[model samples]
Target: MPFKKYLLTGLMVWLPLAITIWVLLWLVGALDAVFGGLLSVINSVAPVAITVWSEKLRNIPGLGVVLVVSVMLVTGALVSNVAGRWWIRQWDRLFTNIPIVKSIYNSVKKVSDTLFSSNGNAFRTALLVQYPRAGSWTIAFQTGVPGGEVQNHLGADFVSVYVPTTPNPTSGFFLMLPRSDVIELQMSVDEALTYVISMGSVAPSLPAATLQKPKP
Candidate 1:
């Protein structure tokens, strides 16, 4: 039991950082491949002229890292303007017209923008909910309220919560539970996630008394 607790605690310590580093490495690899391929295409078109500079610029070891960060910053700046916004719309229109690629690309882009954009609201609050069965609960994020016909069908009090699975939070279920039933945890989303994945082995320093709040 002690060893199990320690192992869970250790995973809580390392998993976030490990996953973050893995994602960062994956992005870097993708960028490197894209830029390298572009350089190869240029080299094929113009054999003598762009050989050395293109090779160096495209894959300058650590420079690629700097370039990736710089490009992200530049892209952030561009999307902040009116003309840039129009250009973005046009680009999106082109993508939307594309056959199968549109669905995949647009869904991913929407999620990324929601999660990463400063103006967008997503994962705004972490909640505790009875999951799978009564008495047994899990941590979930309150994404938003039930909308449209679902709201009409389900009633106004239902809310949408994203309940992520352990070990791999990438896949999860979205449940529309009654808003009154959801227990709002005081802990942040990151802390709640650690608690969930560790399966209570790494208990958060929260007390039952502290969780008691006067009904609003």
Candidate 2:
């Protein structure tokens, strides 16, 4: 029994580290594969000396990630100028003129802009709400209020919230509830996410003001 307990404890300590390393290795392999494919295409029509060098470059570990990052940095720098803006507008126009591609591209672009823009309000606040049934509470995030015809029907007192599932936060339910029913939390969005993803095993500490005892 003692040996079994010890083995279980050791596994608890090492499991998280093992999974983290495995995920990182997978990401590196995927990036390397992209670069390898590009080199393979180039090798088809190039001189023998050039093809040899491309193959050698593909074998270098982490080079693909480095090259991709460098390209992003250079692209960002270029896009910060006036001419770059003009070109980007032209690029968007070209894409937007396409039939099927425009619909997909525009939908994705709108979602990305809302999620990643500096001034966007999505996921900015954490809330405590009763979900699935009354008297049962869960952590949720404010993703913005209802819009368009839904807003017209729901009125001004409703908000949109996302409740993420435990252990895997990617998939979740979206609820539009009355603002009065949701209690705003002092904890940050990141803290709330950690709590939810840990299945309430981890909780954010109370704010300093909440910790102070009231004078009798």
Candidate 3:
């Protein structure tokens, strides 16, 4: 019984570490596949000397992550220029003309821009809101105030919140709650997400100032 208990404890300690390493390796492989494609393109059009070097670059471990990051930085710098803006507009126009592709592309592009843009309003804060039934509460992200028809219907007092499911934050419900009813938490979004994903097992600690009693 002691040996069995020790074995179980060891498994518990190593299982999470093993799974994390596997997932990381899988991500690296996927990135390397993309880098491989870029190398193929270079092999076709680049000078023979450069093509030979690029082929060797593929064998370097973890190079894919560096290449991907470099590409993103270069792309960001490029897009900040006037000429790049013109080119991006032309590129967008080309994609926008494709009937079916345009619909999907436009929708995804809008969401990506809203979520990732520095100035975007999405997921601005985390809050506690009553969900499913009254008195029940859940962690939710404040995805800005409602807009368009939803805003018109709900009026200006409501804020749009996304309540992500436990252990999997990707899928969840979107609710527009009245600003008065929503309780704003002092926790950061990452802390709130950890609490949600852990199903309340990993509750965030409130600030000392918040916990302290008011002066009598």
Candidate 4:
């Protein structure tokens, strides 16, 4: 029993590290595949001296990730300019003219903008809400305050909460609960996500003040 316990303990220690390494390797491979094609095209069109160096660069593992990061930085810098904004708008307009591609591109672009923008309001806080039934609570992310038609219909102060499912945080239910019903927590979005993904096995530590009863 002791030996078996020791083996299981060892596995627990190594399994997470192994999976992390595997995921990282797979990501690098995927990036290499995407950038590899562009690199090949560049090499073909480049001068003989540059082409020789590019061919060597192409063989180096993880070079694609570096190039991709550099490209993203340069693209971000360019897009921050007025001329670049005009060019991007024109390019976006071209995509918007396409029927099927327009819908998909616009939806994805909106989501990406909301999630990545520094001023965006999505997932700003964690909350404890009674979901599915009363007296049963779950961890939820505060997406934002309700607005538009939904807000007008509700006619009350309501907060938009996203209750993510166990193991897969991407898919979840969006609920609009009265502000009073939701308990705001000091724990961060990342900490709440870890607690959810671990299915309550991983608990986040709370401050003593949070645990203390409020003054009467």
Best by lDDT: 2
Model 1 Cα lDDT, one tens digit per residue, 100-194:
99999899997788788777557878898999788988889988788888999999998899999986677899999998889987787788887
Residue 16, candidate 3: C-alpha displacement in angstroms = 5.4
Which candidate, 2 or 4, has the higher lDDT?
Answer: 2
Q: Please, what is the whole-model Cα lDDT of each candidate in the order they appear?
A: 0.84, 0.92, 0.91, 0.90
lDDT of 2 at 97: 100
Query: What is the alpha-carbon lDDT for the whole of candidate 1?
Result: 0.84
Candidate 3 residue-wise lDDT, 122-156, digit = tens: 88789999988899999999888889998888899
Q: How many backbone clashes does candidate 2 have?
A: 0
Candidate 1 residue 5 C-alpha distance from true site, Å: 14
Residue runs of model 2 more than 4 Å from their true location after superposition = 1-9, 213-216
Q: Write the per-residue lDDT of candidate 4 for residues 1-216, one digit (tens) a residue.
A: 999999999999998899899999998999998888987899878899988887788799998888889999999899999999999999999999999999999999987887777897789889999988999999998877778899899976899889999999989999999999999989988889999988999899987786796867
Model 4 deviation from the true structure expressed as Cα RMSD, one decimal place: 3.1
RMSD of 1: 4.7
Please give each candidate's TM-score: 0.75, 0.88, 0.82, 0.82
Q: Model 1 has how many clashing residue pairs?
A: 0
